[model samples]
Target chain A: MTEEARRSPERAKRLPRAVREKQILDAAVQVFSRHGYHSASMDEVSEVAGVSKPMIYSYLGAKEDLFIHCIRREANRLLAAVEAGIKPDLAPDMQLWHGLRSFYAFVAEYRESWTVLHRQAMSVGGPFADEVNAMRERAIELVAALVVSAGARRGLAEQAESSGEGMAAALVGAAESLADWWLDHSDVPDGVLASWLMNLVWLGFNDLVEGAVWKPAE
Target chain B: MTEEARRSPERAKRLPRAVREKQILDAAVQVFSRHGYHSASMDEVSEVAGVSKPMIYSYLGAKEDLFIHCIRREANRLLAAVEAGIKPDLAPDMQLWHGLRSFYAFVAEYRESWTVLHRQAMSVGGPFADEVNAMRERAIELVAALVVSAGARRGLAEQAESSGEGMAAALVGAAESLADWWLDHSDVPDGVLASWLMNLVWLGFNDLVEGAVWKPAE
Candidate 1:
């Protein structure tokens, strides 16, 4: 029935489902960042993505589902970035350094994604919050595994292994807080930020693993 | 307005304005922690505090203002606890340890206040975020001053002093993150948690101050 319209140049190049979903997410992020979750609307997202409202609803489901999809996509992207950055062959410290560099770089490049994941997703305080928290826990476990495996190899991993979960959780929080601070202070390089955290946590951690505790002097 | 009502045993011991405000803030912290800022109500806060709705309005203004008041008061209390715990005469490590101990203890004892400050305050963007962030910076500066001045005394503080702001910011974040994690893992002692963070960050910071860098191995 619409053969003529379909043959038109404007409709000649139809996007794949993946490409269309990506476009929708990009626009949804911008809209969500602008208006927040409670105030953001699907119609605005549809208009911004240049897709029909029905297309968005059919592809992404409801607004909450769409928002959760955005969070999941961004979370996976971030985790993938860190995973890709760290070379398995590299030393533990170097692995951490590379991982952190990728992390800060992701935050620098995708401020909207980071904001949605770090702030808006957590603020919602429902199923979305649980999803984000689960993602966070996964990230922490990744770091803890790295720390424990590295220390075990060096024969310096005992104490850290014993309390690796808590330590890893704290490290994730610190990185998150630093990234949030970086939003306002964008002049600093991502490497330096990563290195600062690496130095702050890794060295102290190394020392502890070696049984070199920094005790209070009388 | 009746003399008989005023003379009743239940009304005989009316709190002073300062005491009443403290009671209101405590109640606000609990309610805000439970329901969050948006879901929490003035009527609920008044009822919880055992005060009149008019009293809450007259004393703390609107909902937003009351929330800010609660944040400010709780923030001051936290900082005060840290300040009181750290003696100026103590060594840097000891000073930091003491400060962190008090911080963890405060979080453990006043989980509701900490929840309101850390989660609810930061979740709400705009003015509330700014206020919480400002208070956060103040806390960081306090820690930075402690770190810097102590290093300077031992002739090891110059390097740390240069990037002191960033270092302090990260340290504060790590501590905050630890406290958040501590909420779920309450079995661990506050002193132990504080000590873990102290070992995790302070020792590395000390090494950095001594010009020991954890460089990426080629």
Candidate 2:
């Protein structure tokens, strides 16, 4: 063995807790996204990370712990991206547009993270499902707040027929499904995709806040 | 074993091929929904269905084939439900509302089927993903056609800026997500849940066709 290897054989050089944790989490995300929660193994995560299994355990606790960490990190990164994209000073519609655009862009850039959070983590269906569901609720609430507050500013919040919670749930669902569709149709610009949703949802939402209803013309 | 059990050694009677296949698919859906696609096993499916593994194989092919079959059956059932709900003679808005009600009712009745088709199948992410995605595309097309033809009846089809495909993707996503939310909030009636989506999407959609653009108030 080389002198340095002989001196310290565990790692090239021991990384700080934060850097090592990041590397392990990054590798964990890749492995989890590919193999899914139950199918994924700690050995695979370690091999992918180029770190040893014991180190992974010491650093991330266990398989479940590592998976949860990946979910929380990616979820926050996503929420943070949308939050950063929204400028409170901008008009509400503009703010919503920016949030949507930021959402699409984030999914594009972090496809693995998005897949892990949106697809794999939720698939396991246990405590992890609840964890991811909480994240989902937060996301829905953020968008719903945007929709309702925009209406509230116009003094039309109480007059609306639909509840903000339900509308926000639909809006988040639309954006999410569109994002998944965007994975295939990557040629479409994020702005256009976001605008399509804006027209499909916000226009109807604005009218509803103004108390307009579409009925069958008998 | 009782005399009847000793005589047959398994199963109560020699059911026909079609009846046997239905039994297998029903069991497969239950097992897949409870344990998810990857964790679910042929043995468990056999136990659940009261059929031998060979019978499952002969009847359904393999695990993947079984999953595809379950997804296909459920997707067709859902699409059929919506189709049955729509009457061509009805006004566009009413037809859409009927379709929405049908969707919610289907989910409420066959939630396990919906869980397998909507959540578990897509989560598996392989040939099954393609199969489910094609089903999703068909669903989106169905809804988009409804929205566009309604606009056509109003002579506002050509004037609209958004394509039916994009808008439909948003609408289907909203429904799928809202349905997921509905699973937790079962106290809400199917009609209310369906109406929430109708208002969230159709109302805005109606305004869009009428050339109402929601722009930031400058």
Candidate 3:
């Protein structure tokens, strides 16, 4: 083994308990991604984290609570990544493009985070699904706001905002869904994937606002 | 009870085995949707179908094979529904618009079918994911062809097939993902969901072909 790997105990004791909790949660996401929520057990998570089950329970709550915490933490991390990527000096379309790239980049680097957010969260019943859905709605609303203001600034009216919500839903869904698809298929970079959303949504929304409709042309 | 309930033995004998098999398969899908694939048992399926367990085994294979059968059957039914709804006489854009509407309508009415095709299929490992993804790719390929040809017809000379394929992945993912979102909040009609997609994608794709890009506008 390498020098760092050969001295395992020296590394394990270096971090505070909070840092250790983060370590455990990171391992938990990986396990959850593989087996899903129902099949993933506390025992496996503890084993993967190189910590005892008691130590895990002491830091995070029981299984469901721990999962919720994971979702909350990861969702914020993802959103923050997107938010940080955008620059206010850029135009609305450019801002959206930057955000899309950020999302794809985040998911690409953190595949397990996307998996936990997408696949595992849905299988869960009751409050967990509701929780994830709420977070999703928040994301949609954020995107919808971006679309509305941008459209308005370009002379598109207030009425566009009503339909903007639904449009945002589709745009967000396409981005998240395509991100998952890109995971399985290689050769598509995060920038290109993000660019697809930009060219498709931003450009198209621009066209409709400018009144260049896609008609029968008969 | 209905007259059919009173004439159970008489009706059972008269019904063909092919008809009976279909009834059994439908019942299996319902049961599978409520509980996941692994959690669902043959006994539950038989009980739901009002048939014996042996009959189910005889008609379908073991649990895994039976699930795969359900995926294939449901996938075919869904694809056919979409195909039936598209009219070639309409403009290419309009053809796509109708197809999206039809897709949402199918999901709304045959929610169980969409659920089976989407959620349940992905839950199982290996073969089921591979098969469903292939079927999904075929659907995307059709959309990709539409996008690529539309781009070419406008003298753009851009081969959007590959990128369209990626967008298709995003679009399908969005449709399926939004459908899941819609299930919790049913106030949004199938038509609204479909049109949301039409606006988001159709409008965006239209812009690219026209070369009216959504830039900073400096």
Candidate 4:
């Protein structure tokens, strides 16, 4: 092939928009995951993707825009993982078991995505933190919905919802917190951590379903 | 008496070491809490304390030294608040309750102090994070002790101890995450958040005492 033919503009015309966007986001997540949002540079992202800076700008708009896209993409993946794994037809306990196990597996499979979504994004100073926080709230609400459904099966939904929103918050908070602890204790399988949470909160929540409430000693 | 004569050398003399140290720490907490550790300035801290830069240097060593001192001071204050509120005489549920309540209260009263210890110190990246993380670990272990106490009382101490460490880490993480959530929802009293935690985890924990574990559905 001639040198002129080898240097054709066909290279630029070859890649589809969707494929290029993914390439940019993958590189952006890699860099942002390492140094956090404030410290990550557009220059490094382009170099890592082997694309020019202008290509990144045209495809992803700007740094913050790129970050939100990453967050939205990662959040959808995580939320969907939990959703797909939940077995709605089963008993509440079984459903929660599936959901918790799915969450642990997702974290184990996608450590960088979770880190970028949870730690790195939340620490920054702007709309991205809000975006991350909203996703977190959605996760908590998912737990709350599960708790409410479980409680409703036994006529206990009102209490769990009224008082259970807070319970949902605490339960989800504990799960997220335990997931982080599980990271350092990688010696322990994520399945065990998921089961531990199931035994801790989910079991206790079910007990509350049967007219059981822990009251202070008289 | 002449004003100049009354003032004399006594007025120009340096403050006692103990007093100077406290003043510097108070000022450092204020500055660190306001601007975060990186943006905080020694000059501002000295000025806030009504001392000179030289005195700050002689007393606190360097910026990192001053930050560690601030974290140590504030962490101790928070730990003491938690420890003082806990009673080994109580059941594990109540013991955990009191500890959570005390923690929330400390975060509420010493808002800046806790923020400096939890947020800013962790961000600056060094021994400061380690120092703060150690104090936080102690707080978690303390909660683990309460959980273990119940298991011990039930003659399941061995079982509890084996898993109590992870539970402690999860419990602490839950409390830390909720404490952060409560910061934005200040209208909710500390007792409320503490009680919510008690209902969520402590109540469930009490069930663990009774041999009720939530198992996966068949």
Between candidates 3 and 4, name the one with more favorable TM-score: 4
Per-residue accuracy of model 2 over B121-214 as CA lDDT, tens digit each = 7666556666767888898888878877877877877643246767778889999888887776777889888877777788777777777766
Ranking by DockQ: 1, 2, 3, 4
Misplaced by over 4 Å in model 2 are A1-15, A24-57, A61-67, A87-94, A119-131, A147-162, B1-15, B23-68, B88-95, B119-131, B147-162
TM-score of chain A of 3: 0.87
Clashes of each: 0, 1, 1, 1
For every model in order, what is the iRMS?
A: 2.2, 2.8, 3.8, 3.0
- Residues B33-89, candidate 4: write the lDDT tens digits: 999887899889988988778878888988889998899989998999899988878
User: Which model scores highest in DockQ?
Assistant: 1
For residue B129, what is the lDDT in candidate 1? 65
- Kindly list the per-residue Cα lDDT of model 4 for residues A1-218, writing each as its tens digit: 66665886435356888988888888998999988888899999998887778888988889989999999889889999998999889987788789989998998888888888876765663567667668778987887788888778888767766655566667777877787676667787888888777767765666667766666563
TM-score of 3: 0.77
lDDT by residue for model 1 over B1-218, one digit each (tens)? 56866676335556788987888888999999999899998889998998777878888888999999989888889889989988888777788888898999999889898998887876665566667777888888898898788668767766667666677788888898888788888888888888889888988887876778888777
Of candidate 1 chain B, the 10-residue stretch with the lowest lDDT total is B4-13
Q: What are the lDDT scores of the predictions, listed in order?
A: 0.83, 0.82, 0.77, 0.79
Fnat of each prediction? 0.59, 0.69, 0.58, 0.39
Which of the predicted structures, 1 or 2, would earn the higher TM-score when compared with the native? 1
- Which 10 consecutive positions of candidate 4 chain B have the poorest summed lDDT? B5-14
DockQ of each: 0.49, 0.44, 0.35, 0.32
Task: Tell me the TM-score of chain B in each candidate.
Answer: 0.91, 0.91, 0.88, 0.91
Error of model 1, residue B21, in angstroms: 2.0
